[model samples]
Target: MTRRAVFAGWWVVAGAFLCMLTGYAVAYSFAAFFGALESEFGARRGEISLVFSISAFLYFLLGFPAGLIADRTGPRPVVVGGLLLIALGLVAAAQADTLWQVYAGYGLGVGLGIGFSYVPSVAAVQRWFVRRRGTASGIAVAGIGVGTLVGAPVAHWLIAAIGWRHTYLVLAAVAVAGALLSGWLVRPGPERYGLTPDGDPPLPSGASTMPAGLGLGEAVRSGPFWSIYAGALLMSFGLFVPFVHLAPYASDVGLGEGFGVLLIVLLGVGSTVGRFLFASVTGWIGRRLSFALMYVGAAAMLVLWSQSTSAPALVAFALLFGAFYGGFVAIAPSLAADYFGGRALGSVIGALYSGVAFGALLGSPVAGYAYDFFQSYTGAILAGAALCLVSFAITLAMPEPARWLAARRPGP
Candidate 1:
């Protein structure tokens, strides 16, 4: 295809981006709703937090099966189905008269939708490009940054205007429309269209398009896999803490509600820039270094967060934390695909993210409990920073892609 023709893989990236944008916007926007939910239900911080915890746990936990199913079937159907569930869940949450109903509707429905759609959509993008894989993956997942950039503020505004129930209803409508459009844009792998990765050309009648790499079992048994898993698990324990508590912390410290929510907006901005910037630099600095630096930077920012009670300090923490976090998130898929092969890419990614899923389940709620016990966020913030240092240390031990492949390449 000519440069004028535009590659098919970019379209896949676009679709995946939109799917993630919708899913994560809805997912992360829970933070914006945190106060409202607590007020509405007359619940404590730790108890109300379980809603997000349940949602995160389900999506990450279910990602393994959801990915396997997508590997067998096409991602379009899976994404479409997931989006429908998200909309249904939002509608249910809108009508919820109790917290348990909210748990069922928002928690289960949104979680299941994301589980089914996220990994599959991401893996599909990886199949479309090799030369530009890093750039493509970063752009695709940057939807998360964009979504967060847009979703929380929008949700916050809507909540103030109409209240949280109606805000969810609005989000549901957006999710439904985005899902349909994204699913339509989502296509099968390049082979389905007789094209090679990066849209090189039409292949010979049966020219293999699949990249050679380790299968799920082989990948699971590797040291690199476990190391990556452990790193994600530890880093994740504090990852969602800010999303859930930043606003509340600001409130407690005397920053107004508007500014607290704006912190998330700035986070989105930094995250979007980081995704693009880091992806651009990956070819030069290399993935392992990028991965390690992200953790270190995140650790430093979390340390900053523990001390950030002033407006400028809080803003600095948000932007810096978001920049590092965005890079961290944008690189995961490409890193995993680089370590393993794309043979069962979706399932491998699903398995890897299970660590993150478990971490997310505990991250927010544990922070909430910490707040309840300590009456402050300092301990949790510091803990998250310490975990980041450990992640940095562990990831530092990882071998470069060439060495890793040389040492543990899969046999036919």
Candidate 2:
């Protein structure tokens, strides 16, 4: 590949990154809209949460089909279609008169749209990289952190300036632009381009064989698959509590809500840095060491979070916490590919992420209700911290995939 080709690949990565970023900005930033939706629409907390909860449900539920379609059809169409759905959903939501209408428009429509976007983007990156798959994945997934960083503050500002209805219209316009860019930049398997990520030999002129690996059904039956799934579940269980409760926690500690909001921005910056930093670091440290260290560090920070009260302490927590979380997100899909080849990579990874939804669902309300019941976030933080510890232990049990040799095997 020439200089131009390398730059094209990077552009491809950036396009995928932007699509993933847009999808997450819409899906994950619901927390920023939560209070506003309730106050403006005269809805209760449970009613407001139901829309997002349903959105989360559809996002994970639709992922398997999305992955399968991407495998057979191609990534670009799936992603483009998903982006259109998101735009339509947001537009419909802007027109909603009742809470249930928002559920129909935002919850189901946008939820399904987000579900379709991730696997294709990840699959495209997988197709492009061989030697540096981990790093590439880290870079691509880092887009989510970048999107979150911008989306939260922007959403807040938009809501204040124009209210939720008009805010969603602006979001719809952004989604349309993202869709066009993704369709233009991303393509199917790398083999079609006459090369690979690290510059490899093409197939013999007469040969027609492709690399073989475990299918989703076969992969799920293996022990290593379960180990990865369990680890995801454990980590996700505690992932959002800190973000969700940060503002309220600041108020409890005698800080302004603005300070709490600012902490979220700090977390986003830390996460953004971590994604790129860990991508490069993994090249030097190796996956097992890097993963273990990050998980353990996250657990320690969660513990520290329980004792924190001051602004500086919370800021420190956000930085460290964001780093590990970023590492965890970037490494997960590549880790899946490592253990199981790209045979059913999309479906398998999607299923694993689906398990993650359960953990998050339990974590969010559990943290909120715990604070209500206990009048303190201490118990919630401890619960979240304990889940991090469990995630660390689970990572330890994961067997390393033996690379090219293991790639040829039926199981790890």
Q: Which model scores highest in lDDT? A: 1
Relative to the unseen true structure, what is the C-alpha lDDT of residue 298 in candidate 1, on a scale of 0 to 100? 93
Clashing pairs for predicted structure model 2, backbone only: none
TM-score of candidate 1 versus the correct structure, residues matched by position: 0.96
What's the lDDT of the predicted structure labeled candidate 2? 0.76
For model 1, the run of ten residues with the poorest summed lDDT: 201-210
lDDT of 1 by residue, 1-412 (tens): 6457888889999999999999989988887898899999998888788888888888888788877888889789999999899999999999999999999999999999998888999999988878789999999999989988998899999999999999999999999998998999888788777788887765566554657678889989999899899999999989888887888888889987788889988888889889988887789989888998999999999999898789999889889889899999888889988888788888999998888888889988888998999898888889988998999999999998878897764677
Candidate 1 regions exceeding 4 Å error are 1-3, 202-210, 409-412
Candidate-wise lDDT, in order: 0.88, 0.76
Consecutive 10-residue window with the lowest summed lDDT within model 2: 204-213
Clashes of each: 0, 0
TM-score of 2: 0.90
Once all C-alphas are superposed, what RMSD does model 1 give against the true structure?
Answer: 1.8
Report how far residue 71 has shifted in candidate 1, in Å. 0.9
Across 1-412, the per-residue lDDT of candidate 2 in tens digits comes to 6454453456667878988888877765665676677676896544665676666666766777888898888788999999889999999998999889999888877888888887787777776776778877888888888876777778777887998889889998888999999878877766666655544555667222234457988888887778778877777767777766776577679986667766677777788888888777767866755676667778788888889999999999988888888887787787777777777777887888887777666676677667666787788778777877787788777666764345545764
